[model samples]
Target: MTASSEARETALLAAQAAADKLATDVAIVDVSERLAITDAFVLASAPNERQVQAIVDEVEERLRQHGVKPVRREGVAESRWVLLDFVDVVVHVQHAEERAYYALERLWKDCPTIPFVDRAAPQGDAAAPGTATLSADDIDPASADPTPLAPAPGDGATAGGGPLQDEDPSAPEAAGR
Candidate 1:
């Protein structure tokens, strides 16, 4: 049994909203087969407490725009992990530390992941083919924001937004530019 259409839509919307706030590793898990309370879960990670709060706020705002509101919320005070339960769907915005420690993906490994399309990334452009796309792990927490997180690594695109040339001189984009 998979998530219903309505549940999937809500989950995807929350996932996109989290991504809009620069949340990382956005994933949607179909928990309908396991849980009766909710149909799906949207999991995302933030670099810190403030970012966690930001992601949560954005997720809530975006969902509300869709005429949906969280039926329950948890872990907002510390901002380490915030769970927004919309009944049909649940959004978990966790700080990097909490995400690593909890590893929600591992726990839900048995369940199939629902496809998530990040509206932030252009359509048909999952990423530049052949270019190593950056992930949250590649980001330098202090140097990622504001700076465009694109192009080859070491090309001043730090996760936290810092200017540092890639050490590799062999890579065509960074080394030649």
Candidate 2:
């Protein structure tokens, strides 16, 4: 295989290892030629804030073991969404609610989605086009509404503001931009 292909495969494997360690749902997207930021995106979802943080830690640890370090990280404080910026592969570990709110899969619908094999899945049950299924475990009960997570006290954000007035269900940003 070409060097690039090998790199892609290695990155995917690394991501899978990290996901397994954290027990989160993972998806990889190949956007090599379509975007400026990176060639691949590894998206994962955790059940809650603690899991999100754990997943991010695992991802960083696994990648570091491979001599790959993220150039930057964002949203670590909120744990709603954490972005790990590797030069060629970007990892996104989000809380279930945030994952549902920003559906990265739909945003990059045109790109091919790399199958994310759960460590628990039987051999050969990895994802395939038009065959992906969402189990009950994947759904976040809190994301049904459009409201953002309430800020902590002293943050000055009021309750009951409701969903953003301009929220667009069809927009990429709505799905995790």
Candidate 3:
């Protein structure tokens, strides 16, 4: 059998969210013929632990819009690799090193790949070719002890990255000025 339309839709949305958050090599693998559980798996790679968390958060939020929730999540603490089990679609967002080491793609290489399209970015121009436009959600604002956000290496941005996440977007804060 093949992945149902619902499963495919979820996988695609997950992939798009991952891409929006600067995840790399995002792809969907249909594992229905080999697995009895999920219909497809969405795989993505982040350069660092922070980006890993960011991608995961985006995936969860975007999927939630469709009224879907992950049944289970693992490896969130380490942030080297994270898994989101959304029943029909399982998403794997991994760090660069972990992605190369685990190589889940090789295991499911036989499965046909489902195309991923990021609606927010046309022509695959989500960010500059080599730069990532970090978002406020990149850092966990709800952490027990929140840490400052540092721009990822090679992003060509300062430590502040973009607009202050805490600042109100509607009106510019003139306190510093």
Candidate 4:
């Protein structure tokens, strides 16, 4: 099944809001066929934590203006990656480094992307929004790194060869007999 019209509207609004904040690599992936959780995923990246937060704020504010509020929010503390879940749509605003490392688009490459043209931009200009197409090159130059990433010290390695995750000392370990 494809994304519902309501979901597409929400995703487009979120994408446009991110673009207004100068978020890079803004694209909306139609994931309804793959995931039941949401109809679409709006992926956007910023060069730093501050810009990441800015994009997230804009998305939330813009959607809220349309009487659509996110049902949940995650990763706001560090602002490296923030997820705003709006039930029918989910918006992911990530830092450039995290964006390159995670590569959400690659993960959803099989899905189709919805074109976004900033309503605020004028028509027929190369610098205008409609003329720009989201591409991997626009994500981050680091995404092109040929060298495989090594797990950070003390972090476990995943089968994918990426850092599994940082060990959280505060979390309790499993019980032993």
Candidate 5:
């Protein structure tokens, strides 16, 4: 692999390691060859604001330990979305709600998803030294079907219909009754 590719991979792995250390949900998307700015994007989601900050801190600390520094950082105050830009790679740490709202996955859906080896699972049934036992199904979202909920009808419109609803507000009241 080219030096740039190697460096991108190293950054991706480092970000993944940082995410694993914080037990955050993470994904890496390769956008190097496609995008002009970055090579890869490390997306991670935390359960809450605190965890979001923790994940961001862990990622920065871990990458810094490896002599990698982010060129710029954003969205740390609200802790909803923390972006770490390493020039070649960009790491995003977001709260679950914020992640859903922004939908980075959808934004970069066109980019190819890189499959990484699952090292979080336990090695054999026998417990090994310093090894934590985890089921293969634990971290694999593919193991189950995530049923999509249909959007509520007329959600975008007013409760009764539109402007006419105000003229006949009693209609909605009667329906509810």
Candidate 6:
């Protein structure tokens, strides 16, 4: 079975909140068929613990604004990885290191993914069509962009906010000019 529309909507909202906090590698997995506990998973990462916490906070606050609160929260102390369990949708905000090491996407590779686009980001920061979901193997952590979610033109592709192309004027790299 697929995720309920409600779960997908919540997961997308959580993803947008993470993007607002400059989270990277944002993705949503439909785990309803694989897992009975939750319908979907929203995964995102930051370069550091502080940013991870920031992303988590933003996700929580945004979901809360919609009158939805997490039924449980985990791993907030170290900020290496924080999980917000909203029942239908679970948000995972991790440090880049932890994200690369644990590779949650790989663990749930068999599941389908949900596409996300940052509407507030410049057109060039949007992801390419039909390439939203990426596995750990698909990413080279060392080469991954460490900059904020607003991807620079020459940096690389991002989950929701990254340079669309170097030639695009709307690319973040050109925003400075």
**Model 2: per-residue Cα lDDT over 24-143, one tens digit each:** 557788877678757788888878888888878878887788788878999999998999888778888888888889898889888876655655444554654223467777877466
RMSD of each: 11.2, 15.1, 13.6, 15.2, 12.5, 14.2
Tens-digit lDDT track of model 6 for 1-177: 899999999999999999888788899999999999999999999999889988988999999999999999999999999999999999999999989999999999999999887655555535453235566998976578665455655555654553454358676765765
Candidate 6 segments whose C-alpha is farther than 4 A from its true place: 124-177
Residue 127 C-alpha lDDT in model 4:
70
**How high is each candidate's TM-score?**
0.71, 0.64, 0.69, 0.70, 0.63, 0.70
Query: How high is the CA lDDT of each candidate model?
Result: 0.84, 0.71, 0.86, 0.86, 0.69, 0.86
Q: Extract clashing residue pairs from model 4.
A: none
The number of clashing residue pairs in model 4 is 0
Best by TM-score: 1
CA-RMSD of model 3: 13.6
Across 44-122, the per-residue lDDT of candidate 4 in tens digits comes to: 9999999999999999999999999988999999999999999999999999999899999999999998888777666
**Candidate 4 residue-wise lDDT at 160:** 46
TM accuracy, model 4: 0.70
In candidate 4 the C-alpha lDDT for residue 22 amounts to: 85
Q: Which model is ahead, 1 or 3, in terms of TM-score?
A: 1
**For model 3, how does the per-residue alpha-carbon lDDT over 90-149 read when each residue is reduced to its tens digit?**
999999999999999998999998877555553465664334465776756646345756
Clashes of each: 8, 3, 0, 0, 0, 0
lDDT of 4: 0.86
User: What's the distance in Å from true for residue 51, model 6?
Assistant: 0.6
**What are the runs in model 2 whose C-alpha is more than 4 Å off?**
1-3, 124-177
Question: Model 6 residue 174 lDDT?
Answer: 56
Off by over 4 Å in 4: 128-177
Backbone clash pairs in model 6 (N, Cα, C under 3 Å; residues 3+ apart or in different chains), count: 0
